[model samples]
Target: MNWYVVYTKPKWEKKVAEQLKNSGIECYCPLITQIRQWSDRKKKVEVPLFNSYVFVQLAESERNSVFQSVGAVRYLFWLGKPAVVRDEEISVIKKWLDTSDCIDVTVGGYQIGDSIQLESGPFMAQKATIQEMTNTHYVLVLESLGCVLKMKIK
Candidate 1:
């Protein structure tokens, strides 16, 4: 069985994953623990690493079963077919999430005007250009998205 990505309804990734698993479907919804702060308190919470998406291992025949699960939107399609995720990619995600408490990623050796791809977060797989930089942060211009982002690298 190959791993395919499925989109879920807003804020429903964990719920959909649980429902699918309960129905004997193998699903993976990676999560990261983050400390959220309020005026009076800070608490650690598990949030979906990739919001609104879950990975499932199944054959073509099992697609309908997964679709029937609550909050499942649809499979992510590439080249007019359901996108197949490589095992190595899944392994990398699993390993990173398993080992890291708080993760920070930075790409070095990229010159100004060089395009770089974001590997994770809300802009996963999106390309942006290095516009400016300092010792601790970068200013990226996302041309297609029509926005500029200031992100820290640590």
Candidate 2:
């Protein structure tokens, strides 16, 4: 059996994982606890580390059953074949998640002038450009509104 990543519907990572497991399929959906603040109060919530994706361990013959599972969209493909994840990579992710309280997963390398967006904050949904970066801060320019904001990296 090999581990393959399955893309799921939005906000369905956990649900799909559970469904697959109930059907005798081994699935892994890593989650992280995040402190979310609202107007009322702050609460710790478990959120999927990889949104809309779940890793399933199965043989190639079991692919059809996984695809038939609820909320499972499809397998993540690379070069026309389903992408296979090594056991070491999965173990590393599990280890890091187990040891770290806060984890930042940077998807790709970013350079100056790259377009970025604020995932969460007052400026949520706002798009900006990476103007400059120092050892401790990021200078972002909100191009749509002609405003600049400096944020200290934590």
Candidate 3:
């Protein structure tokens, strides 16, 4: 069996996986806990590594069942038809699930002047400049009153 990525409805990773698994399809939903801060305090929360998506192990012949049987599942296309995630990617995720470290998916082609918010740290809530972009983080610059501030965002 090969692994295909399925895009699901918002906040429905578990639900979509359940529906697929109940129909005899194997699925994987990896999650990581991050510290989220509110106006008052910080809280730890678990969130999906890949938002609104899950990976299912299925043969090509049985792929259509994922869309027909799992109501929450929306599509499985990458460039064209169903996209098969690389074996190395699946293996890395499985290893992280066993060890429980933070996991993330990279979004490509993010350009300068693209609107972005700081995901964490001291610069939270202040509008900033995406001075530079990298595979894992951005070089952000912020202006505080009359002074300049800078930080890296991941």
In terms of lDDT, the best-performing candidate is 1
Best by TM-score: 1
lDDT (C-alpha, whole model) for all candidates: 0.83, 0.79, 0.66
Quote the positional error of residue 81 for candidate 1 in Å. Answer: 0.8
Q: In model 2, which runs have C-alpha deviations exceeding 4 angstroms?
A: 100-154
What ranking emerges by lDDT with the best candidate at the front?
A: 1, 2, 3
Separately for all candidates shown, the number of backbone clashes (residues 3 or more apart, or on different chains) is 0, 0, 0
Candidate 1 Cα errors over 4 Å, as ranges: 101-108, 112-134, 137-152
Worst 10 residues of 1 by lDDT: 142-151
lDDT of 1 by residue, 14-78 (tens): 99999999999999998978899999999999998777899999998888899778899999887
TM-score of each: 0.72, 0.67, 0.57
* lDDT (Cα, tens digit) per residue for candidate 2, span 82-125: 98887765775577567744433232477899998867544556
- Estimate candidate 1's alpha-carbon lDDT, on a 0 to 1 scale: 0.83
- Cα misplacement distance, residue 133 of candidate 1 (Å): 5.4
Scored by Cα lDDT, where does model 3 land? 0.66
> What TM-score quantifies how close candidate 3 is to the native fold?
0.57
What are the per-residue Cα lDDT tens digits for candidate 3 across 47-142?
Answer: 887778788888889877888554455556666776777665566456645764343424346677655554543333545555666655655554
